[model samples]
Target: MAHELIYMDNSATSPVDEEVLKEMLPYFNEKFGNASTLYRLGVDAKKALDKARQQVADLINADVDEITFTSGGTESDNMAIKGVALSEIQKATDKNPRNHIITTTIEHPAVLETCKFLEKFGFEVTYLPVDEDGLISLDDLENAIKESTILITIMHSNNEIGTIQPTKEIGEIARKHNVLFHSDAVQSAGKIPVDVKDQNIDILSLSGHKINGPKGIGAIYIKKGVRFEVFMHGGGQEKGLRSGTENMPGIVGLGKAAELARENLETRMQHNKEIRDALIEKVTSQIKDAYVNGSLEKRLPNNVHFRFSGIEGESLILRLDNEGIDGATGSACSTHDLKGSHVLAAIGVKPALSHGSLRLSIGPENSIDDVDYIVASIKKVVDYLRELSPLWDNETDEYIGDRFEKPLEDEDIDRY
Candidate 1:
């Protein structure tokens, strides 16, 4: 009972599993050898790196050679976008035109900023819009494609809202048009089943820390036939695409994490969903006028988002921290930005409600007791904050008494 710091922020990151930590310990001391060297230690390190590559590739049904290790998700995205841009210009045959990239306005900064940088070099970018449910319409995506479009980069799942995009449809569109497609699966990889081959992903990005692995390591899966220029160039490592000395320990840790995640995908997914649903159910049942933000049907198994009106999300997160519950107000990267989440605002959430948005993402290691603790803490915090508001006039205390058995008497309950 004492070890009860409830963590509901798996979307931001997760604690490295004890086994994964053990696997990485060797590279820090006894096995500290440059993967590019020719000695025995180096040989062992190189083999470990290669095996790790296969592990990551296996998770996504990609070829081992297709996966290139990067610092993390951001670098993978930058490499995907910038690498394609440079490669296109260098090898543009005929009047194929080196012009534009099509992406959604709701993309993560990794994709958004990369598109902005490519624009500085005379390339055009079209940022498509998303509907109120955080789903980008297929028709809008179709209209955005241009004659000079070189790539389409979108996220597989929204980090804040947990809305899973129609990646398969988008991939099909890209492939039909002969344009490249890249999906940043940093949030979706371990949370859901992702097969790059089945999705027809030209390029994919995933981070290690998201799947109970060590931080500072990620992978980019470039389809075997796809051509992308090198982002990191030096030694002949990574087939000359990435040249730095490999992070053997981090890679080993990543491999172990990936393997474990794949092996337990179904079981972990079911357990996480049960815990997540309990959190969502308990919060809405006990709190007044609280609701889940994003598509309930097409969402991550462990994600539960909420927009608690009349309270600042940053304040709620701080309050939750005091209650020994760790969660988030949107992405960890935007904690200090003070802009109140462009992702939430993009889905047409009001500025006031958007300011109070919180994302509670669960991990496989968490338990029902953890969810119950989080729910209880949230009920107390939200009730306290709502009491302070002069605008709290429509509070309810029925707790869905009879509606639980009936076939949804109240239409608005599902929306909540």
Candidate 2:
């Protein structure tokens, strides 16, 4: 069995950074206190929470009052959607309670399933389709908006294909229509710059785990003056928006992670992009029939998703694991089932190709050599599996073997 694996699945969740952990340790014990308390201990807790909030807020270019800490990205997305949806219903004197939301088919399940839940409550959702290159048309977006449209929630970057949505354009459209705008920036926050004010986003969601922060901590950036319904109601915590005792350690760590990401954003982006692009070039050129699934230029810096045709993506992933390479196939949250990627299918990839997507999301720690070894290992495992596949019956070699009954040339074999 292989040991000492290379971790290339940053998009799923990043390993916590040591420095960020150090920053959070005090909150768990020595300096622990409820921020809601009025004593000296409470004052200490409030200071830490406020500083952390400022750190997180600075990274997104939002005011401290606009940021509300949550359990994680799911709660943030839920609050952004349900919060705005509820507010829209309560304020509208018209029949706009039967409202509509516009989003894409490739959104994360947090958004997709949340919309599904809203549909059960009379909200109509229009899932716009992406093109072959995994891009939604702006014209289609404009046509989809109606006066009853209450919110436009689109992801900043797709987790699987790394396609960067035209968020600025979409935000402008939402503003022109007087609709609330939200973006799930969990996948794009640290990898790319996100400014709530500049983007015209009324609401934004992000996860700490995606950016080397503690797991269980995240924040929702609600643009000041944008009204939202409280997700939970109790004592006035989180400015009475999300009522609960704060998670001190997790929030501290998340803030440190955000600050660190801001300090190293440019350096990390350039370095990860270099390693990611090198792997893409190596895989596409060396592995026959392997092709990237998203746009070549406008993509996430640390992602390289490829389809190795005629081979199961999960099988290759398991084989890569045996060879000491850690990666992922499809979204980590939805890996329980072996269905082919819905993201690939949304882009009109063939069933055969769609079933073969391997997403190698590089992190700041990966190198060209690590990606190179992974590429070579995938080629070996795929070739061995194809040879043993009963589904394959075409010519595979120049010389006639026990498998082939007639004369054939290896060149006649399908390279893909």
Candidate 3:
């Protein structure tokens, strides 16, 4: 008999919703027109795009004009970071060159790498460190700000460990210092409440695929009156901020997905939380020497991350795949890299423990049965891999168990 397949990698990407697909179908042929054109077909496409903008705006509690569609989260991150930096530099006087950006060490590569890229252009960057619970200190962020500090970009929720950052506090700090604040909300937008206005966020990035919409479509919310230079150049589209032919079908799909997400956010969050809590409870209780990563109480409702000693995460993932279960070790974007997760390292996870990390993010489609199956399958896979591990001796098991049961020592946490 074929093994039943269970998918628990929603943080990496989710399956497109049926309703979102239905909303996109007609745009392929019937409503196919360049939104930039002036004909009837073009006008219809333009109207669809406008409606989508409103949908995205409403979801984030932003003005309709603030939404700028992009290719994906990476593009949105790049546009927000670079756009703000360049815009500030242009407006800077001889004595006030705003060339510095502030971001956390645990940020997604899209944000981290963008900050790094700016460093090559004579821009300075401060990568604030996170604690063992994957939370950054508001004091550290404030101290990092200087006269050259132009923008502060951070992720709303961690992709690997699922720790939700205190973006509202960070936003207030930015506002007080007169700095532009941008957050990559790709992981938190649909799963949690993200009010740009309430958080005092000047800009935010979100992806469609992360919210059960089609891939290759995302948006950046730029608060009105926030000065930002254009990143792309072409026909004056997206108010000349992003210049290209709009992806009407993808936009419509994303809009519908956002709308549905808003309507069902509370119910979906509860469902995900139950499955996540159940899986975590079962796996930790049944599997010896297992411990969760990040702060349990402040994490995303769908995320459950854990680490097991004596086995590599990749090996466990392969073993679980044989049992028809799918999950991930770290960000899907960096899965090809053999190094330990930067997010884990930033949170002070030892290299050995980081190598064995596993991230299981539940979604609306995952049920209690699926959670049970995942727990069982993971337990089996970890046991099998542990047996093959050279470090899996009698003493090693006891040590691993003690490490999980006891509190972490001050020396255990690494600082950047």
Identify the leading candidate in terms of lDDT: 3
lDDT measured at residue 131 in model 1 versus the true structure, 0 to 100: 80
Q: How much lDDT does each candidate structure score?
A: 0.83, 0.84, 0.89
Candidate 2 — which pairs collide? none
Worst 10 residues of 2 by lDDT: 407-416
Name the regions of candidate 1 deviating beyond 4 angstroms: 1-3, 91-96, 390-416
Q: 1-416, model 3: which lDDT tens digit per residue?
A: 54787888999999999999999999999889999899999999999999999999999999999999999899999999999988889877778788889998888889888887888999888888898889999999999999889999988999999999999999999999999999999999989999999998999999999999999999999999998888799998999999999999999999999999999999999999999899889988999889999999999999999998777899988888888878999899999987677778777776677889899988888898776777878888888788777656654564343244334343333222
Per residue, candidate 1 scores C-alpha lDDT tens digits across 275-319 of: 878888888888767889988889899888898867778879988
**Lowest summed lDDT over 10 consecutive residues: which window, candidate 1?**
407-416
The parts of candidate 3 lying over 4 Å away from their true place are 394-396, 399-416
Point out the higher-scoring one by lDDT: 1 or 2: 2
| lDDT measured at residue 281 in model 3 versus the true structure, 0 to 100 | 91
Candidate 1 clash figure, as a count: 0
Least accurate 10 contiguous residues by lDDT in model 3: 407-416
